[model samples]
Target: MKNLINYTVVLLLLVFSGCSEDLESVKYDDINPSIFPSSEADVQAIVASAYYPLRGSYGNGIHSTSENGLMFILDATTEILQGPYGVQQEASLHSYKASSTSFTRFYDVFYNKISNMTLSIDRIEKSNVNEQIKKKAIAEVRCARGLLAYELFDLYGPIVVAPLEVLKNPLDEQPLARLSNAEMVSFIENDLKAAAAELKSPAETPYGRFSNGLARMVLIRLYLHEKRWAEVEEQATAIMDMNYYGLEENYAGLWDITAPVSSKEVIWAVPADYAGTSENQWQLMVLPNNFPGRGGYGTIQSSWKFYDSFESTDIRKMALIAEFTGTDGVTYNRANPANYMQLGPIPLKIHPDAARTTALTTVDMIIYRYADVLLSRAEALVNKTGTPTQAAIDLVNIVRRRAKISEIELVNYATLAKFNEMILLERSHEYWCENGQYRSDLIRHGKFTEHAIDLNGAASQSEPYKALFPFSLAKISEGKGKFIQNQGYN
Candidate 1:
């Protein structure tokens, strides 16, 4: 939160100094409290603004996926994989993101985005904004805002239970008023419900705004986190009930560059134009050398442990990597798939367009999907009942089956603990780098700290909390300390 306060100031300065040229094209100033959405074109522009921030994310368009990366660390602790996150020599993870400039930059990015949202809301509320358009924009903003707050909670602990417009202090020495797990879940649920109610139906937005499907996805997430088994099942089942979403017929093709347009598997996606849009540059995860058809610096390389986790029958193992050495064109050293995922096995979750051609091809990323919904339900069911029923088994097996391990027969009740482990395993494999949201899953399973590598390179010594970031020091200085930081770290 301190970082956000600081960044908010910097962002305000930037906004004051010069505005996004893109906004100029939209006649942004025309979007006033007194006169917005007077016409269809204006409404469309407001809808377009909804897609902002997501693609134009901060840090020079580099998304650290602090949530995703942190989750990777958590998964590593569970023997999920030894080195996928920071196992490499250069995966610069810091003890306190508050200490890192990158973390600060992301914090600022969030506020800048919220600022834009505020503007949108102000314009719509003050002007003759299109009713339909206003509904869409408001729903999208609330959903996006809720998502950001939820994400912050995922990172820092939920010590501060106030809204985003307000700020908190990390340095405050007083005992914190943190939200309990159930309370935190309630917060997320209320926001999602508001979004779900006000947002358009699925047919209202063909991925244009926050739709019923998206709300269902968020609800499923909330229910899963709250350990509300029946609710999780209902939400997941609701999504599956929709005709617009499901697992793509081809599992490997699900990540194909054209898959976003080709399949409905994607529940939420960050659409891209590659040239016209913010670069889908995450290829840096495994963009090796010349012989490769893709482009990226290959930073978040795969680990040998991750590779070894795949059963021999798992086709996802093969889909996740390419082993052939392009000796004639480029060379990459052979790295172990498990502990030594040294950029050896690239993330197959997203494939770049071979043509590098049109805007439509470099589709936006998928943030939510049907598979995740099922896995979340599987988690909830297992948590509620020690033994996973056939339905739970089917949920787990269906994903594995899609990965070409069709004969996977669910077995063993060994213990409730063992079953939870299995649910997490399903998440690790099914989600992995796909959604960049797996870290929360690890935290929820209480495995995040068990596997965390602190500054001393030892597992964390503190009790695991919500992992929410504390208020930025800047916020505290600005008198935003109605809130407080989590227990351990400031």
Candidate 2:
């Protein structure tokens, strides 16, 4: 069944040809919506198609146009990850212009996902499937749409809210304008809330489907970004009280394809197969060029500063490989920091699998996990109380303890500002490269610009507007002047 779900998602993606073009241009004339999705299996298939676009972000060799993948655009701009020269380096250096092609491709992929989900929702609504199944299918589609909208907001600031109606009537020429940030947030919240009520709990949800817990996780992040402390605390607390999730005992085992499903830690994960069928390209992008198996392109390397941040006792540091036994069975040590250009530390967070090579590994990309929930709760509590509560300190300690690091005392962070800083640092170590959370985490903590300036030296402190990406010229043109680029990029 798991294989079927993965195979179905891949098949649907092919059947739709990834739907990269404008929704208006997508020729739906061949199929009658009136008779489509006429059965339970049909409705489920449409719902399954909605999940296919998530593969777009990591370049499943089908949907994503840019070889660099969306994760590069998201993580390269942060302090910890550095990419080889060009747009990736520019992204890391914060030197990217409005015309940056990689960012533009990433922007397109996201909108394409939203467009696909919108059409799925429309078809599900018109289908004559059993009422309960139809409603559940719609809920699942909205959950995907809501999460993608949240990602767009995180990347591009404010965007048109899905525009399902506009997409439904492609002939209408009135251009869609970007919504206000508040409006966008509200729209995302509405979708997530509605989905959360109708979706199954984590325990009951099928392996690949979105669950109620996943929707709440998205809400927790949204509230955190909005600085709505009370809401963050409320949402985080609800997830914690569910008592159905907990941190994986071994930090490194979480990425093992065999372990992710059985682990209590994972809230929601994008499933993949290690036999080289359904795969994630992150390992291929980040592994050192000289290492074993299918030698990676050496595109993404960890920054020295990030390597230095880890304490000696931290078990999580094992995930960051400075040395490895290659496929030739020879030990290779990383070059000196001065020679980092040729041989630097590469992140093995998505550990290489012995069974297969060629950049396709079965490691499931984890979207939300219990450890993040605990950290979010800790941050929310500190923000809401203006001081670190014992409960907040305890939550932080739980994650720290799992990492084999010393527990942080509340007294060490006497001020709310100091406590918040510690929380952000803990997150940097705990969640680096697990879905683009580090980038958003830095922005939320107001450290993004400062970190970029410190690391790249080429970045200017005055360019705080780089926090939000510029609207691609194509997107603006699509809107016919209704879409304005972010202020500074203009």
Candidate 3:
């Protein structure tokens, strides 16, 4: 799949050269609708362009494990991450403003891609290609569009989505309004549902490409966000019925350098390499600058509170580093305060690439996995029943058992509120640095601001209105007073 990605990238470049002029009178090899997307590979190149922004490049991909990526930006706003830098500190304390580029950049990057994907899908559907190929190709683009839309919507509510007709007429000066909550939900839901119907199973899909399971997983997340318990249950169960996925026996092996591409546990992961379009530089971002065997800038850390939340026997905590020997022959720990230890334990969720000579590593960036499917179903079941169900507890226990922790008896969480609390904590521990959905989980449960205030006291700028991030001032200005900033922000 990685090699196929490289080929598609080269094809994309060859097909769409920005330097070209005279589109109508271009050479035979030049990109003309009649000349390009003329074959299956051409259709792939068109679809690949939509997938480009998902690569692990800083300020480019939503899946990037780097600070600029959606994972870091979203996770920084939760208990899983803490740092003393500009955006990191702001996100950690819920002090971000509309102008904070870290939060606003996603809108600028992905909103345009939605339009591009829409255009790509339209072209693929109108092409004279094989109907079956067109169906799958169009489905791929829709899945990418839906995934990107859901991501942006999760960060900021109800994004401004131009209609396909409006997109086709790019020169028109039609200013579109942000979709209503219902419209946005329906729009994203429709795209994902369509994609899921046509997309292949995980076993049939090329690694890193969207699969039916991935599309359904996004639906599950969307359903969870909307508190649509029944839909979440249905979507999760659908993935389970596929019977192609399950939990990996070893939790830590999920992120091994030579990650198991066929690991049934992984529903979707970005195929990465030291030298590839997708880069995984997590170790460089979190490792202390002077660590014994390796080197890193030591940027982000997980709070000691979060680390302490895990049971001592939890195998998941093995990834969080609390102590390390510096090159100066001094061991840095919480007791012996150091620059890195001051914030908290290093959230080295991804294993350190010991053989790496630079920041990049080949660890595949996991986006969604089967464990999430289990937890989502458990949470949805409890929410749907409005009480702790034995089945829900069993599902939660499945994940806990993998974490090497004692199972919580149903008697312990008899109330709906109590079960939700337990499930939220379980999600935080189970999915800390993976995809940053934990922030959404916290917000959905109305604990986002509460947890910040509880942990940081007066320092926390968290407010109930901060449940949704603010739109950029520029976006508002572009709206010419039509777009209202999120409540509470100026």
Best by lDDT: 3
Better of 2 and 3 by TM-score: 3
Best by TM-score: 3
Candidate 3 segments whose C-alpha is farther than 4 A from its true place: 1-30
My TM-score estimates for the predictions, one after another, are: 0.76, 0.89, 0.93
lDDT by residue (1-490, candidate 2, tens digit) is 1111111222333222222221111122245555776877667666766666665334532222134454556667876677668776778878766787676655665565676677778777887777888888899889988988888788888886546666665555466688898898998999899998999888776555678999999998899889898888888888878878888788888887563666678887766654333357666676655576656666767776787788889998777777776666667665533223332477778657745645566666666788888999888888887978888999999999999989988788879989988888888888877776788888988889888888767543326888887777877777777788888877
Clash number by candidate, in order: 34, 1, 0
lDDT of each: 0.53, 0.71, 0.81
How would you encode candidate 3's per-residue C-alpha lDDT over 392-461 as one tens digit per residue?
9999999999999999999999999999999999999989898899999999999998888877789999
Q: List ranges where model 2 is wrong by over 4 Å.
A: 1-29, 56-70, 162-164, 257-259, 274-277, 325-344, 459-462
Tens digits of per-residue lDDT for model 1 on 213-310?
78778777666555678888787777777666667767667667653543567666555444434434445444444325544444455554466667
208: Cα error in model 3, Å: 1.2
lDDT, residue 230, candidate 1: 84
- Pitting candidate 1 against candidate 3, the one with the higher TM-score is 3
> If both were scored by lDDT, which would come out higher, candidate 1 or candidate 2?
2
Cα-based lDDT at residue 378, candidate 3: 92
